[model samples]
Target chain A: MVQAAAVAPVPVPVSTEVYQRLQHFYARQMQSSDDLDVPAWAGSFTEDGVFATNAFPEPITGRAAIAAHCDRAFAAQAAAGIVRRHVMTMLTAEHAAGDGERIHTRSYVMVLETRRGQKPTIYCSTLCEDVLVPVDGGWQVVRREVRRDDL
Target chain B: MVQAAAVAPVPVPVSTEVYQRLQHFYARQMQSSDDLDVPAWAGSFTEDGVFATNAFPEPITGRAAIAAHCDRAFAAQAAAGIVRRHVMTMLTAEHAAGDGERIHTRSYVMVLETRRGQKPTIYCSTLCEDVLVPVDGGWQVVRREVRRDDL
Candidate 1:
């Protein structure tokens, strides 16, 4: 008969495959130049997801509010007739334990803002904090917190 | 005979367990106010870990230099009788895939400095890019990069 090991079980390390997916996630989100799909972005979260920003007093919860906020921001940018690009580096991802459905991800993001007739000016360096939860579709962000880097 | 059917293997979601451990990692390194064991802290990374600051021109590599730098900082504070404390908040962690080791992590940290006489002040809000690798003992850092929030 085969004998079972007596030592305590150690936690399994995160796989490289998961890490690659996370990198892809950031590349899709922060590196994109085109306007983000508000509803699509917001929908990439749990039903009761929360979106918090340094600019917001409180977090916007649920898909509807999150989508509305994104739409508003995009609309404001449209009115200004400015094209903005966000570049991010120094990205990282970590998985949450137990359920295996949650992840904590962070990255350094620099936003480049350029108007039709003005030179491109970079805004504040920003950090993207996300809590991702896996659902039926795929891994989606349940909570997102954006904090401006202190200059 | 059992019928043979082709089943496409679905990629399992990222593990939450790893994420929880990462939360602990952040709580320990970034948020802890108590005196940390510099040697052990340095041991958290691989032998050739990288530590960089905007205050410095080049990145410090290896555990020895990393530990030395920490020791110097601690000693400086003690010698100066500054009674200083480092407060870190707005911390976020992400998994790094650049190397194969799962010990790689990156984060954003807001450092608040409190001196004996002066009012609590902001030291620097920057991103912490760390690479952690598992060793014979436990997880250790591989490489670390810090991107300042400001220009």
Candidate 2:
């Protein structure tokens, strides 16, 4: 038998497969949010997910609460005929030293808002730090903190 | 001696190290352009690099020509007091069937422009397809095609 390194949680490099797997994960997660699919977007997170943003005074906890918050934004965007695209960039991911089920990621998200006959604008730019955990054969964001550049 | 794959240039998986290395490469390359450092930006490409964009009637061939083209743009942005940040997203890298030195990458770049005392705007969103080769222990873009989503 091979001896394993005895260490606690520390940043560990993942494989290329893991990296691309994450690319797909974010692509799907952000798409649901951009498409204003309330249930789908909420499903990207855990049942007890926590979302905190610099623009908001209080953190929105739990998947239902997060969904409620975004549902309103979605309706407003739809009413205004605005299409917002959540573009993910500069994503970096690492796993806990000893826990394969846990991963940490930091990504930059730029939201572009476009209206009919008008040029697209950078509605918002924020950095999202997420703590992800595997559940039911998929990954879910357990905690997300958004740092808005505008704020 | 170890056996090697006989394939020519197919999609080969890279390690996490290569993926992160590319992240750093783009971060530095885009920073130079955003800072209006024309020469520094040109240095990111090979001597015979080619840059094609739909906005231009003809492609810019060679690093010198590319530099000359961007130099004018940099001057104009400087005069207009615009800061354009190039944010890279959804980057996928793959190597040629058997050649380890040739790597192809497709990346999305979002350019956010900000003027003094004004909110930032999505100046441009583009897909950059690049062919990269190592030179003198560093990677240089040998060819690049820019596709603007706004076009």
Candidate 3:
């Protein structure tokens, strides 16, 4: 008979302050429409943070890569004559492990993009999955996964 | 000259421990497939917490209303033989001013409900906008505003 290993007890929960920090970080990120503060946006994460967007096939890692991703995103929207508004609502966030710094967060995102001469607003909606981490600037999104809601 | 009240200096950000505690608290609240722990959940908010759901017309205020709202939700789901598996992904949380306890948390939620019979599973996806605060139990969800992702 094989000996059974003892199961460790669950880790104590995270504090409320930490949670609030994360919330504020995201609020600013989403609320930023045009002329977003690039450095501030990137500063939300650790130096070696990761960011994933719906447009990319995989995640973009590191602060530099994350900043670059945002740059391209903003540029593309500008070229398309599209003004995009990202609204994050109905959120649920959780910890991946007892002592882990990563948090799994979920929310619905409605992207309203208005282009020149378009009568109705072109809208895209999806569910966003993100990994949040505590960093020097409070809390920032380290990884984001987006799934289309309709499909 | 009426100058905009010299923009007040930004308040110091919340600590990382507070963010972690909140993540853990949400993780625990979501672990259940049954009733929501309102008392434990309400404890996560400030004295004047705001609670909102996708189905409700107006926001519910205070701990008692929050508890009532959660209780009603759990009871309704249990009666329907519907199991709720709320998965939160792509989260961003941040701290805000006032009372030193308010935070805005946003994330994507892929909600699934399964029945005993061979019926097709029901999936309702949305974004969760939560108001969280620090309490004796670490962090609690004072308000949850669920918004549907327009298909």
Candidate 4:
């Protein structure tokens, strides 16, 4: 009898359905933010979801806090005569080892900003890592960590 | 007796697997060009692929022609003392009503440009449409059309 070698199991790529749904999830979530629809974007996260970024020192916990953070930020941008758009791409998703309902995803994101009568600028570039879960027949972000490229 | 009403079949969304694969495809294809890997990027098209854009009056058809066009353009950018990056997002994919092997996709694209010691700017923004087919186990572009959002 031949001895079998033990191999480590790597995470499988998410199904086509799951991958596409996540893409749509990100798109809608980002769009809502760009459109200044605070409730819409904030609702993308779970009630107790957390958002952390290198740009800010503190992690924002809970959907309500996330909404408040975004509201203030959007207000500041609006007061500065800036128009903003969020673009996300380069997404890769895989299933978690023991959870069929959980997925890990990484994406590249950029924020485009334009002032009146000015050329659009690449305001920021960041790498976003997210842990997602299925809730209420849709995907929700449980945790998000962002690392700014220019920082 | 009730007569059945005619229902038009709207294009169905492509499978999740296809959507994810295409996202990878575009990322690799665009990254090659941004890296000045001309041949690598050009291989993304079929032998008789067609790329048309509103910015150019003539469409570049065939793999060789597309490669030449890209080569010349990349060279020009290199000479201009600037670095360029391509970011594509907001992708939507649907299947044609009558074709199982064909997929139609639309995406938003932006070219980010930076000169030495200068801030990065959005050089162009466009809407890109592509007709895709699976060839030899991977996806290839059969046709593409681009409309500049800023123009």
TM-score of each: 0.53, 0.61, 0.49, 0.60
Return whichever of 1 and 4 wins on TM-score: 4
**RMSD (Cα, Å) of model 3:** 10.4
TM-score of candidate 3 against the unseen true structure: 0.49
All candidates in order of lDDT, best leading:
4, 2, 3, 1
What is every candidate's C-alpha DockQ against the true complex, given to 2 decimals? 0.05, 0.13, 0.08, 0.22
Highest lDDT against the true fold, candidate = 4
Displacement of the residue A33 alpha carbon in candidate 3, Å: 11
Per-residue lDDT of A5-90 in model 4, one digit per residue for the tens? 23544678997777778886776677677668989989989999999999888999999999999899889988987766678878
- Give candidate 1 regions above 4 Å deviation: A1-13, A31-34, A117-119, B1-41, B44-62, B70-151
Candidate 4 residue lDDT tens string, B78-130: 99988999888877788875686788887777888999999887787666889
Query: Between candidates 2 and 3, which one is better according to TM-score?
Result: 2
Interface RMSD of 4: 3.0
lDDT string, candidate 3, B16-105, tens digits: 665566556667666643345666655555567786665568888877777677788788877888776766654556676444567667
Worst 10 residues of 1 chain B by lDDT: B5-14
lDDT of each: 0.61, 0.82, 0.64, 0.83
- Give the DockQ ranking, best first: 4, 2, 3, 1
- Model 1 lDDT, full chain set: 0.61
